[model samples]
Structure formats: C-alpha cells, structure tokens
Target: MPVPHERTSKKKFYRSPGGAARVTYIRGKSGRHHCAYCGGLLHGVPHSKGVAGTRALSRSQRRPSALFAGKLCTRCRATAVEEAAKVKSGFKAAEAVELSLKPFVLEAMARVE
Candidate 1:
C-alpha cells in the first residue's frame, strides 16, 4: 500500500499544487533541517553536525555560492518573476532585468496575491 501522507509523524512539504515532487522530513532526521537555498539536507553526516550554528554564522561570515551547488527549481520562481515584470515600476527595466532572473525572488513574488 502507498504510504499515507503523514507517515511516521513526518510532515510533508509538497511542491505547490500539492502532489508528487513533494519533500517530507521527520523531526529528528537528516532531512529535518534542509538548506533553504537548496533542498539538500543541512544537518547530518557529510554535512555539519547542525546547521543552526552555520546558519547563524552565515550572516556574519562570508560564504561561497558553491556550497549550495546552485541547484534550484526555477519552475514556479520563473512564473513569479514574469508576473512581476508585467507591472510597471520605478526600479527601471535595466535594473529589473537582473532581479527578474533571480529564481527565489521572482517565484516568491508570483505567489503573493
């Protein structure tokens, strides 16, 4: 039988539209704290003992982008950016040209309202 949505007390964060391509994490498991930049598990073997310290120090310490592997799902993010570009703004087309390509920013804006 297929595993139920909330198996083993794990909470699932499904991809928008809520289905497959979903990601779930158990409270005390490696996936419990995944990197916000990439979906990779943040705290566990091969990774730091815990990201809490790294995440906190990141604000003060310089970090290289190579750490996150630059892997991100641009599907929804691209849509949000397209939606924002549809509006006129003082940010100017030239400046926005760059922000428009940032997956997290674009996609995040799209989901709002």
Candidate 2:
C-alpha cells in the first residue's frame, strides 16, 4: 500500500481550533474508505477531504467517548464497563480478596429431612 500522502492542511480536520496537527488514512484504488479497526467500509467520515495533519473522526465517532462516561453505546461499550468492574481489585487498598460462589448462592436449597 502506498504511504498515504500527507495531504495539505486545507484537506484535514482537527478537534481543536489549531491547525498545526495532522492525520493519516487509506485510499483504495477504487476510492473507497474503510474503518481502521475492522476494515469495514465507511461513509461521511469527518475530514475525508480536509488537511492531512490531524486525526479525523470516523462516522461512528462520539464525543467524550463512551468508555470514559462521556457517551454511550451498545455491545463493546457495556462489556468494557463490566470488565472494568471485575478488574477493580487492582485499585483496592486490600492485598487480597475473596470471591464468593455465584451459582451456588443462586441455587435453591434442597429439602433436608
């Protein structure tokens, strides 16, 4: 793949008021844009035609970011929160923890004669 040329600043977009920064992207022979993560095709991605020295927001871009409590999304966003909760032990002052059995706790008590 050709190193995407650093297009002129007039052809890029920056989150801030400044224009000194730049960004990068891929341009296929067919002139189709794709997602950087899954390579899925994208449309209306910000700054596809702006300057070259800034990070362009994808069509799916969300301000403040759902992971940081700025925004929200389905799927991975919720999963991230749950996983973060599980890893909370790392931040706890205690050196060790005792995780109780979940299924066993939920189980019904059988009749004991």
Candidate 3:
C-alpha cells in the first residue's frame, strides 16, 4: 500500500514576490536574531533598537538610512544592487543625459537672457 501525502495550505506555502528578495529577522535559540535572507546572526549588524529615542539622539546614532543595507543578508543585498545596476544600465543614455543637462541648460538660458 502507498502512503498518502498530506496537502499543505496556501497560507503556509505561498510567499510574496518580494519575500525572497527581502530581509527579515528570525529569533534563534541563542536569543539572537538571525537574518532570514542570509541565515546569519543579526548581532553585528547595526539597527535602531527603538524609535522612542529623540530625533537628535537618533541622528547621532548609527542607524540604517533609507537607501542603506536593509534586513537582507550582505550577499543578498549585493546581488540586489547588482541586478538594479543592470536594469539602470539598460536605460537609454540619452534620456539620462537629458535629465542631467536640464539644470545646466536652464542656467545657460538665464545667463543669455
């Protein structure tokens, strides 16, 4: 007789499209948090423990910036950056150049007038 396999629910099986690319914290037996993306302990990584601190104190503290490395492991973050750079490189150079030159063109026009 063959054994029947149990079906898993979608809630437990499905992961978001961004899930693989994102960094999440998982509590470990050691009581230290681990990076879900990298499987590395989060101890060495710097993050703001709480938002209760004042703005000045927070600013003085070394916290992750908006574009700073997120919860993902270092390896994952590097891969993500590489992929983004590839996508950005695919953009038309002329469009980028135009955007960069707009301010200079405006300045030149002002000088001329």
Models 1 onward score TM values of 0.26, 0.25, 0.32
lDDT on C-alpha atoms for all candidate structures: 0.45, 0.34, 0.41
Global lDDT for candidate 1? 0.45
Q: Write the per-residue lDDT of candidate 3 for residues 5-111, one digit (tens) a residue.
A: 22221112445687754333332222444554556754343334433432335442433443323354556445444444433456433234344334433333343
Positional deviation of 58 in candidate 1, in angstroms? 4.1
How many clashing residue pairs are found in candidate 1? 1
Candidates 1 and 3, the one with greater TM-score = 3
RMSD of 2: 15.8
Top TM-score prediction, candidate number: 3
- Give residue 99's lDDT in candidate 1 (0 to 100): 56
lDDT score of model 2?
Answer: 0.34
Residue runs of model 3 more than 4 Å from their true location after superposition: 1-30, 43-62, 65-70, 91-113
For residues 1-113, write the lDDT of model 2, one tens digit per residue. Answer: 44346352224344545756654354523334443323444443333344342235442552333332222223333443443444453543222322332211112111111
lDDT of 1 at 71: 34
The TM-score measured for candidate 1 stands at 0.26
